[model samples]
Target: METAFIESPLGITKIVGDEKGISEISVLSEGTVSKKIPPQLKECVSQLKEYFNGQRNQFDFKLNPQGTDFQQKVWQELLNIPFGKTISYLDLSKKIGDVKAIRAVASANGRNPLWIVVPCHRVIGTDGSLTGYAGGLWRKKWLLEHESPSQQQSLF
Candidate 1:
């Protein structure tokens, strides 16, 4: 696996993957390179930059996230979450065809290794409040604000 670090508005990010696909992308306070950046990773980094800049909405890079089959199913559902939209964990649980598994769904979401690309940040509390985010609640708030339909004028 190859890894590279890039600075994002949310924080420093560490991207890890290989020829098959990207395995992980997580936020970090600082970078520690255990592997060199590969050609495929360069493309992923470029696409990530475009995403953060709001120049791109969909990610086209390959991915090979590691997790249980159930977790993979939940993550796939997360991908269906459109950009600039939010879904409650309970809603996601239903969409996955198991309303009783809301906690399991949330747990899978927490384990999402791809971060923004997988869009785990789009999930919120059932009461429309921001909730658990692996990166941080502040970053989650900032991401939602960034993707909100209302522009900065609302705050102004």
Candidate 2:
């Protein structure tokens, strides 16, 4: 798999993928930005730039995240969530047709490897609290604020 890193408002964004499809995208507290993006990752990098610029709402690139069938199902359901909307973990479990799987749904959400592309950040605690983001709660808050249509200022 080819890899590249790009600077994002929250941190250095790492992207990993190849001809099959993008398999991973994650944020780091610090890292060197790639001087050149791989040919396979060019489109994804461009779309990510548009996303961070607020010029795009939905991502249409191919995704090849590695996970179990249950996790894959949960991730697919996550794609149904709109760009500027948030859903409770309980709601997500119900949407997946298993209210009792709320904990499992939340666990899969936390393991989402595609970061902003998969939009795991849109899932929250049943109480509407921002919770359990692998990228750190602060970054999750920043992403939510960034996606808020009525947002008037940057969290920074």
Question: Which has the greatest TM-score?
Answer: 2
TM-score of 1: 0.92
Candidate 2 per-residue lDDT, tens place, 35-124, comes to 999999999999999999888889888899999999999999999999889999999999999999988999999999999999999999
Number of clashing pairs per prediction, in order: 0, 0
Query: Which ten-residue region of model 1 has the weakest summed lDDT?
Result: 29-38
Candidate 2 at 26: error in angstroms? 0.2
- With a 3 Å backbone cut-off (N, CA, C), the pairs that clash in candidate 1 are none
| Stretches of candidate 1 exceeding 4 Å from the true structure | 32-36, 152-156
104 in model 2: Cα distance from truth in Å? 0.7
Q: Which candidate leads in lDDT?
A: 2
lDDT of each: 0.89, 0.93
- Cα error, residue 127 of model 1, in Å, equals 0.8
lDDT of 1 at 91: 96
